[model samples]
Target: MLAWAGCLGYAAYYSGLDAVAGISAGAVAGNGVHGAVGWLFSTGDELGRAGVYALTLAALSAGSVLLRRHGVRELPGAVVVLGACWLFLDSHIFWPRGVFTMLAFAVGFGLLTVAASRWSGRLTNP
Candidate 1:
């Protein structure tokens, strides 16, 4: 329960950061600074957005360590939240195509569940 809560909390925090970054980028772009909006969303891809990604990674690492102390491996917990975020973003932001998007989200959710389960199992046997 703690693991799930922590992961979800981190996911929400990350999303909030992303939202602020997006708004900042838009404001910058609106001020005639073209090519800057995309940089904020680059995350770890480029040096320009390194600070945001670094902060996010640091938060996740700290959260993972805390979760581990509670007898839960971080991978499954992290995967569950991150995977859901990915599915939500991909379907809504990247491709909002109707039934196909719904199907893709369903499939992705199933896959994420399987992956999280397998990852969680390693904590017991390994």
Candidate 2:
């Protein structure tokens, strides 16, 4: 399917960006930004990865817009909250803590899905 191929292509493009950024910053060959949040923050040159995070936010916001358009009102707000968590609050969601990190994403996604569905139903019904 063209949609699947498009998704894969975009995935490859972003992966390439991460690889280029990570490798050029002396990260290991495969790990994007050294493969963990701890490493991303702990790196000596904070400014070096500034572009990476900026680009990340930019790309993510595009999806956030799609979320908003699809009736998932929480995403734009979540993006704001999570972006703040990543930036000002320094939340541990970005840390590498075994399965806890994965759990965080899973939970966040679960909440998002629930909220989105509820809002989606409301938007459609009303």
> What are the per-residue Cα lDDT tens digits for candidate 1 across 87-124?
44323334445345455445544554455455556535
TM-score attained by model 1: 0.35
Tens-digit lDDT string for candidate 2 (32-105) = 54456445435523432353354345436544654756655556545543443244223233454524534644
- Off by more than 4 A, model 2: 1-10, 13-55, 70-96, 122-126
Cα displacement (Å) at residue 28, model 2? 13
lDDT by candidate, in order shown: 0.50, 0.48
Q: Which candidate tops TM-score?
A: 2
Query: Candidate 2: how large is its RMSD?
Result: 9.0
- Per candidate, the number of residue pairs that clash is 0, 0
70 Cα displacement, candidate 2 (Å): 7.0
Local error of candidate 1 at residue 28 (angstroms): 0.8
